[model samples]
Target: MNKAVFPLLLLSFSSLFPAHGSGNETAALHRRYASAATEMHRVQVAMDAINAKLICRGCKIDVVDEIFSTDFRLKDQNSLGYDGKYSEAVYFDPPKDLNQTNAAPERALSYRGWYLAVKFDKNGELIDYYLTNIHK
Candidate 1:
């Protein structure tokens, strides 16, 4: 084989089969997130509380009252589940499959312009969550 051709082939092979380090890193991060589920849930609840407060202000409802009235369904729910990959951000769709009898105005609010993005440290501690519009 020509020297030039050999180097080209080697380069192509390298690109086709990149290192496994990134996969391992992703798995480690996922494990971190999994083990810290309780803490993550707390962070999620706190964020939901903040969203409830924001909605209540414009709707003339008590903040505490609004919280229990709110319901969340993942806007990207299909992108999550058993095959879901770990991600730092996720969005919630409007609530559905309700009995209607217990539904409240706040429960039907749209999260159209917002997304929930979370940051975690190497230890998987909750750093913070950002509620911002999608970057188009």
Candidate 2:
């Protein structure tokens, strides 16, 4: 009976330790995850680049220039809306840059608390942008 119990205990202990994957298999899994992460990052960058080059829907304005221009002015870094969304306001100060573009229609209310709001992602990629008239 003691011999029989010893064999049973040995079998139970052996079953407790399951076989692990080979080193190559583990490395392969890691490589797959790394590749997937890299692909996702590349896709995000491409989408952001496309958006950065887009023209404004309201007036075909060059949004890239407006955001990147040295003369760019802003009332605030972010504006909160009724919908709980935050927007960045681009203040159109004197010597307005909008007049230099033919595509984007010039506005008479450039100084009456008018601005272009832009939102960017953590990677500094343009996500959403729009025009807003907020009385400063």
Candidate 3:
């Protein structure tokens, strides 16, 4: 979370208290959560929520494959996964059924000149995120 957003969100928090009496709970709740969420984060969160609703493991894996589709490609989802060894497959192939390790390969990307490695589960769901930059 960005520390800068906290103060703004906290300012919006006070508006939520009056929502129950006015029968605008949904709107208020939306305001509460949406006040600080970026446009990109909303898309990512909605994607993850829908992905979680997939019942079958194969269905989930299928979503992983679709990650490379034009829609996702427009969102820059084609970042390659790496596992230190840099197998050609990791660089060239889509992120599905990673065989290198028990855990999924880290999907590496960059932002603001810093490198990031996003970890994932076997099913290709995001586990956590870690970023590092080479500094002198």
Candidate 4:
């Protein structure tokens, strides 16, 4: 009887301590998250570069006009039956080279048209702009 009981106890203890699977699933998930974060950061850097170039070229009237015009069109498309006119405003903040640390010139511009607002950083090249009318 004692021998039988001892064998059962040993079996229970061994079952309680299962073998490890080397954490393959956790490692895979971590790798995927890291890759996604890296991709996002790369995209942000590219955009920043584009914005800086646009700012360095000086503010052109055609570019500003096009951005505002597109904003108006989007607002009109999403407008209600009311007769209110949509307005677009552009804000520009140029990066200052005060300390001369050779930092890339920062060009931050935001265009708010109707209910849509678009923002670009210094490194973003002004290739395309998107606006959505979210006015209720």
- Highest-scoring model, TM-score: 2
Q: Which residue segments of model 4 deviate by more than 4 Å?
A: 1-64, 67-70, 80-83, 94-136
How much lDDT does each candidate structure score?
Answer: 0.40, 0.42, 0.34, 0.35
| Worst lDDT 10-window in candidate 2 | 55-64
Model 4: per-residue Cα lDDT over 49-110, one tens digit each: 22433212222223333322333333434542343333343322222334545465764434
Candidate 2 residue-wise lDDT, 50-80, digit = tens: 3433422221223333322422222233543
* Model 3 per-residue lDDT tens digits across residues 43-86: 34334423343212222322322331212112223444564211
In candidate 3, which residue ranges exceed 4 Å CA deviation?
Answer: 1-113
Indicate the TM-score of model 1: 0.24
Evaluated at residue 77, the lDDT of candidate 3 is 36
33-110: candidate 1 lDDT, tens digit per residue: 344445444344435444433222122112212222222222254543353422344444332434466556544533
- The best-first sequence of candidates by lDDT reads 2, 1, 4, 3
Report the lDDT of model 4 for residue 115.
26
- State the lDDT at 109 in candidate 4: 36
- Model 3, position 30, has a per-residue lDDT of 32
True lDDT of residue 109, candidate 1: 32
